[model samples]
Target chain A: MAASTLRYGRLRVVSAVAVIGFLLTSCGGSSDASDEVRVSAASSLSLAFAALGSAFEALNPGVDVVLNIGGSSLLREQILEGAPVDVYASASTDTMAPIVDGGLSDGNATVFVRGFLAIAVPAGNPAHVTGLDDFGNEELLIGLCDVVVPCGAYARQVMSRAGVEPAVDTNEPNVRSLLTKIEAGELDAGIVYMTDVRSASGGVEGIEIPDAVNVAADYPIAVIVEGPNTVGGRAFVDFVMSGVGQEILAGFGFVTP
Target chain B: MSRAQSSHGPSRPPIAFVVLAAIAVVFFLLPLIGLLARTPWSDLVSLLASEVVADALVLSAIASFAAVTISTVVGVPLAWVLARVDFRGRALVRGLVLLPLVLPPVVGGAALLFALGRRGVVGEPLYEATGLVLPFSIWGVVIAVTFVSMPFLVLTVEGALRNVDVRFEGAAASLGAGGWTVFRRVTLPMIGPSLAAGMVLTWARAIGEFGATVTFAGNLAGETQTLPLAVFVALETNRDTATALSLLMVAISLTVLVLLRDRWLRPQ
Candidate 1:
């Protein structure tokens, strides 16, 4: 019995070590490279920043640009929790406030671009949604971003300015998720950025919210103070504010700030 | 129950085993310690009393209890059929039933949406016939939770049914008891402990369901949002409120487990 027990113990230890070795190898990728610049950008900037990242990499050889795209508020929370992010770009200045207040940014965030809210509906406009006034129609299934998110805040502003009380069915976490539901026909209409409607490439149709009631969400970018590659971070932020970056933003239907 | 019985059972575990076990215990304890350390003690009462928390609690209770009731109604019969009835492709049927247990809840939610959403294959006809939309409603929350939780009940009860002695049931039937009476008098009593365990586990899983509920049901306060969804939204907007909610869930779960320790944790 003792002999068998000892053999079992030896086998268990060997397997444990093998498992640990496997995990270490799988997790040890690009983390030790000092030339990598990690940028966390808002999901709304996905297309614009993908182009920007490639352009920045082309200009700076041996410097890899990695992009982490998510909701602006979520990214801010992660940065506050000490995520190793070199650059941060948000869809709204409100989300950047926490980073600035926490002293996590190297300097004040600069407004890079602006986005306008529009009513997004599935192709063919199944609900026959015409304007912001339709948002108050309880008959249609409408979605909006959560109140805390920038797009949601802008949408709420636009609705209030128009004096339309929207019968919101669901509050998605971000603009992209809301757009997805609209595209899927799960939602009849949603409040999303003009850029998102463009990004959908006919999967959805956009009903323009009159400029008189629309709110332009200011996009901000900042370099992290404690990021490992502050130089690269600053360069990326500068590139975003440069003429080329403005062109890319314009191409994606954003208003250059 | 005595030291002498434990001494005769086996020799002391190997030192490596004891060390690894200790590490495992610490791994589980550390997270609880962190949660307790960060919990907002002073604001907890007020936070708990907030409208968001109150709505979420009531919704969670309604959805989870509804889920348990539905699971018990359908899952027990399925478990019995799987354990007692032999048929072609039984293994395939069983695998289909257990798929949600292994699939990510998000994937499960997406699948549910594809099948039940407004534009879904059957949903379109169903909606046209009745004008009954499921998503973003309380019914959606219950359905999402039930889809993810029923597998636990089915697996638990099936295992118990398989272990139950068929002779006792046969004897009861031979004494002129009907099939249903035999099952109720003999088979059910034999697996009573496991049935209770399965119901408790189903309730726990239903309450903690997040990914599927959010993805399929969508987040709407006082309608589809449950405790887990409320906790997630709070995490992004208010950390203190999120911590307070987390502590509340932990306390409630621990109390339930402790209160029912003898029913399922120990075997007679």
Candidate 2:
């Protein structure tokens, strides 16, 4: 019985893998050269960049668009470690500095859009959180992104500006994970990107940051100098900097840089 | 008999076999060598002195010790039950105890979160009544380590219990020794080496545990962030701290294994 149960478990995992592979294969072209563009962007750009990717794909039918979105620091490290990426879009100039300093980027990077931090709480605001000051309340459970990530860096700056040393319950690796906890109501509040609030739909509600205490995040985009598909990389970067891309980003609550 | 043949003398192996074995050793040693080679020896003292490294090392020791202690207290009785008691659903209970051995630590952590997090099934009511939360706290780290490492001790002691001659336990019983007395005297002495071995195994696993601890406890400095979590977060922004923590972990774990190997691992 145990052996048969183990076999059944293995069979389920195998079938799950097959289904995932089939879905991925159906997503886009399996061709080479300018046929595909692999863009690695920060998590904040997920919705905005994905929109641009679809629009760019619509414009250029033969070329496929693949995006790898994650924390800026992690994405930058992947690039440094020679990940197969064509375009590099980061949440901060500091994060992009490594690529440019290493001569791995093609010339100067273009500032695309800016992001700002906001306190996100679960819908209905059960915690009755007001602002940054409320974050310091001992009774509330709060989350902040780890300092290494861009969102966390901005949140730290904001906290210092506000002169509030709030006790944190969890230091999530990235904004997405913290956002997940907040939306699930596990945390009373979390500091995340304004775009994250917009993308959360009704699951989470965003509490605006006062302009005086808020920090503006600088986002930079560059084409990889050592890329296998330089032309595709430049085109993707161009598309992201284009008017349509800016509009799409604005629709996602990103400020025009 | 086959093992006795190998222990007879230091015999020469085939050239191909020697070459392959050398390559395997080098393959494993290469990464450790690289870590050592990149050590900023000049700043080692200052790097270790930093609050991040200091707090992480202290927390790792405390959490792992707590995990080992708790696992011994709870797991010894469990091993005895699984080994000696022939009860209904015994196999199922045994399987559940050993499940963590095969399950991924991260998945184990996720299950822990669902069962013990503030909004968790049992956790929700517990917190409502008592105002206790587990995740993102020091106790959470201990719980995570214990959850993943308890199996090491349980399995080791269970194996030892099953191998012991039942006549010894029966002899103690016939001599008017109570159940608890027999367990503390005859049964325990019969498995002395196994108990020591189990404790060491639990300590080793508990100290090295990372995935479940991070996932369940959530990394927060001076709270839930143990050495592994500290090394991980440090790796992103501070290479020096990461290397220092890594070197410390390797040195400490190696010392433990070396110190324990002869004491408890030797065969009778």
Candidate 3:
């Protein structure tokens, strides 16, 4: 009786393994499709591109546009490492340079939009942060994107131009994270794109930096050369440069390039 | 013949099991091999000598050690109580203790922030009372590491305590030894191996923590950026530096595992 019971247990285990194997193989096989256009965009483009993605989808039915948004440098690294990205939109031309140099993209990346830095503080401005000079206040907790990211570099440029030495409390991995901290009231203030402050929708308030000290970030969009869906990739890039796309971006506080 | 076979060990006749195990081993080895292939050996010393690497190494060491120390002081007693005492909602208490083990570290970090961040539930009051802030500070790193690592120590020590023979402690107590003295003189010595293993495991987990530490403590060099956070940041800007930091972490973890091999790897 015990022997039969043991054999029955083994049979159950083997059948369970076989069923799991079938499910895994089926899942993998179904997910790989040329109709899916994977676009990797910078975090700052999240809301704008999301709107563009839906509008593009509505124009081109049967082609699903999946958006992968993250730090511009991080997305560039992923593309260079061979992530299956069809469209690549970066927050700065600096991040786009490597992709073009590596021949990962189609070599012609048009500057789609321009962004400027602004001081972001939690709602009600508890720290009373007014300008770039207040970033040097040691009593306040200040956050900035990591220096490698475009936003961080731009923020530093603005701070240097304004002659303010920021007393940084943390170097967040991405602009979104810096914004999150500011919105959460964990950070007294952080330097982020003007669009990000608008996206926060009252969670945080923005203090504009003067035009002289502010550096405009050039956003570039291109189609990956080796992307799985090159045809769909080109279409998406063209749509982004279209008048409707520009209008959508402008509504998000981005300046037309 | 069956008795002799049992004494030798259970017979391993399953070819499928052996094949699956080999695949599992290769799954772990491939990443290490990739890291090794990409590691820049010539620039390793200089990379390690750089200020960023040095600051991260020092901060990681300080936070990990502090985490282990705090876990030992508080976790051992909690484990003892769980193992020795029977109370209502004991299962619930055990579940709460194991929650961190199963929780995604990022979620755990967010939870910590909600409770201890500068404007957090308790943190606002704490700041009002003492003018102290935890996020983006070294203390935040230590606290985040400890919150995630303490469970390992607690689980190990509790298991050890459950396996221990209480008769020895009872006899010692009957011989005029106070409860604390009996525990210190008898229970501790008996569970020393497991305790050491638990502490080592806690230290390993603490040192390698990334998601929680980055989320709760924030990544700042010489303050909250542990080795894992440094590795993540370096990966974006400099690949070689990231590889070097990863190799250093692997070496540290390997040394700890090898040192505790007798207690953990070949448990009798």
By DockQ, who's the top model here? 3
DockQ of 2: 0.22
Listed per model in order, the count of residue pairs whose N, CA or C atoms clash below 3 Å is 0, 0, 0
Supply candidate 2's per-residue lDDT for B264.
59
Model 3 CAPRI rating: acceptable
lDDT by residue (B26-103, candidate 3, tens digit) is 977999999999999999999888888888989999988898999999999999999999999889998898777667
- CA lDDT, every model vs. true structure: 0.85, 0.83, 0.86
TM-score of each: 0.88, 0.82, 0.88
Error of 3 at A67 (Å): 2.2
As a whole number from 0 to 100, the lDDT of residue A87 in candidate 3 is 96
Q: Candidate 1's residue-wise lDDT over B196-233, tens digit each?
A: 77788788889899988988898988888899988888
User: What's the DockQ of model 1?
Assistant: 0.28
lDDT of 3 at B126: 99
TM-score of 2: 0.82
User: Candidate 3, residues A71-180: lDDT per residue as tens digits?
Assistant: 99889989988988999999999999989988888977889999988999999999999888899999999999989899989999998999999999999988987887
lDDT of 2 at B157: 78
Error of 2 at A118 (Å): 1.3
Candidate 2 local lDDT, B1-268, one digit each (tens)? 1333355345877899989989978976998998998788899899889777778889999999998899999999998999899999999987898677656777787788778887788778988999888888898999999998887777777777777777878999999999999999987876776677778878887888887887778888888889988887877787777888898998998888767866655434
Give me the displacement of residue B21 in model 3, in angstroms: 2.4
